[model samples]
Target: MKQLLLEIDETTEAKINAAAKTAGLSAQQWLQQIIDEKTVTTWPNAIKALAGTWQDAPFSEELRAAEGQDISREDF
Candidate 1:
């Protein structure tokens, strides 16, 4: 395990302690939990479940037809 040193104002320190107490965790554990929550880059399970929910939506056909068809070329 690695040790990290963090410096904070007294007010911030107090808030961290209070929040940690409220969550029934030590300051270190609370901070670790926060880090874990923030370090995730993938979609949550609920959102992952929605991946193909829109596959058959009415607009999919229109959007597919418009893909890569540029309409902005000059006539000159």
Candidate 2:
């Protein structure tokens, strides 16, 4: 594990400490958990989830034709 100092404003530090206590964790542990959750949520997992869900949806020919028209207009 790496240890480093963080300089935060007093209000931000107080909020983090309070949240850590509410969750029954040390401030460092709580911060680490938040970072891990954010990393996972913002990664390719989100894109894969969207793609999987959209795969089963019915095809829309009208939507496809509209998209083609939009693409052609942007080519000019």
Index of the highest-TM-score prediction: 1
Native-vs-model 2 lDDT?
0.82
- lDDT, candidate 1, 1-76, per-residue tens: 9998898999999999999999999999999999999999988899999888885756776868857666798899
What total of clashing residue pairs does each candidate reach?
0, 0
Put down candidate 2 lDDT per residue, 1-76, tens digits, no spaces. 7889989999999999999999999999999999988887454665667765655655798558656554345555
Off by over 4 Å in 2: 41-76
Best by lDDT: 1
lDDT of 1 at 16: 95
